[model samples]
Target: MLRPGSTTAPSTPLIAPLAAPRTARPRRPGLKAAALAGLLALPLLLPATSRAQETTAADASQPTAPAADAGGGETRTEVAEAKTAEARAAIAAAQEEDANDPLEGMNRAIFWFNEGVDTVLLRPAAKVYRTVVPDFAQTGIRNVLWNLRSPLTLANKLLQGDWDGASVATERFLINSTIGLGGLIDVAGDHGLTYEYESFDQTLAVWGVPEGFYLVLPFLGSSTLRDAVGFGVEAYGDPVSRYLSNTHDDWASYTRAGVYAVDLRAQYLDVLDDMKRNSVDYYATMRSLYRQRQNNYIRNGKVDPDQFPSIPDYDSK
Candidate 1:
């Protein structure tokens, strides 16, 4: 090489350059490979999750101090507040369950027994009745039954010192009984004269009697002590019931009551099924519904925004 490159200043004698560094290219994993990798990585995440939970619990137990960054502090505060509110709501719900039903055991037993009876007899009978009776006839029967309650509604209205309500009841009864063919038709209601359902229980509530506790009666699903007493009073004072007891057989009123029960159960079968399906706690759900309905009734179906849930067209609907 020196003889060939005499003018090239003698090529550096067999000088070998250093080897360049080599980098291995990373290979992209396929779908199965990636899934397997994720599976392998899953166990590592468990500890992280456990740590997060522990941190959350610790944060919940200890009062939080504001962070140095204003935005971070506000975010932390909001999260802490949300957690606290959730915990408080859970505690309140537990307390309410306890306070709502003092006789929970007895009520539960009665509820089970009632359910059995409905399954065995009432439900079957209602199904048959619904299939046998025409819609128009059933409507007529309901209207007649409603017409019969006019007297009791009137009594409650008078006791509540609602003279105008009493007058409306009287006028509606007279018009329906005479012109509506014994109230097998709703002639009065069709003429824009609406009748509201009032009860002596509502009157008692107006007079400052607290609803003692939720009660589930045999054959009657949901009630309170106040409502049960009012129901008894209404039953005894009902004009049709009294007439049947006085003029007809003593058992006739009871027969009439049974008929009424079957009718109501039939009408509400779908509604009750829906409630039970959607409810997390059927008994509690029914109690709440009954209370809501009672409150609405007491206020002439008005939703008092402060005391009750807002439901448009509640009373009328």
Candidate 2:
């Protein structure tokens, strides 16, 4: 017979035992020794068996290594896809910006020149004005300036076929110029005739003139080709400009222009500073903001609410 747990084959029996006469023989001493040895090893074998069973249970309780690897790979793939999508969106936005700004090289050069002027001259003057001028006085000055531009606004409104806007502008101008002490106070605004600023550029936009390549003017800042031409037209046609030209009072025109620039810059001191501090590319940021602001103006504040703060719409009373 083969021994238990042994790999060796049993030897063939030379002769068969007789079935009729079976001899009763004593157990061998070797058999007794083997049985004793088996008893002695039983405790060690039991512990080993128990440890093997525990190992099998632990392996069964956990996820397979291949499955864990697959799950990790899926998560990484999702993250990669998300990053790719974001990159694509950024690329598309950059392309659109490039399309709008075909004159980017020249525009950027002018933009830097304007920035230098603003930083050295305009910004300091604006800071001083903001510091020295009282809030009420600043408001009055702004109102006066806006009121002075009312005629231009009216003309542009009429040109754009906005009769109601034209009427409102006329009423506001007449009411403020007289009762409001030359528009020092917003009397018409209190009476529900809120001011709405209109410009020749805006009229041109309403008239279906496309805004040609973005521009950064010498000292006036952001504009488009159409707007720049419209500005020239407005300047030539302006009553104040024409009167000043006729009277040969160039000094008065220069003074008025200076004050207007200072007041406009003063109003946006904190806003521009914050934008510059937070922006990665200040030029690109300004370009985007300028376009958005122009669009908002053209739409008469009917733009997406999410795109505010690029430029303040003081005319939206």
Give model 1's TM-score versus the native structure: 0.69
The lDDT, on a scale of 0 to 1, for candidate 2 is 0.87
Over the full model, what C-alpha lDDT does candidate 1 score relative to the true structure? 0.81
Model 2 segments beyond 4 Å from truth?
Answer: 1-83, 90-95, 304-317
**Could you tell me which residue pairs clash in candidate 2?**
none
Candidate 1 residue 273 C-alpha distance from true site, Å? 1.5
lDDT of 2 by residue, 124-192 (tens): 999999999999999999998899889899999999999999999999999999999999998999999
For model 1, the superposed segments whose C-alpha errors exceed 4 Å read 1-87, 90-99, 308-317
Per-candidate alpha-carbon RMSD to the true structure = 17.6, 13.7
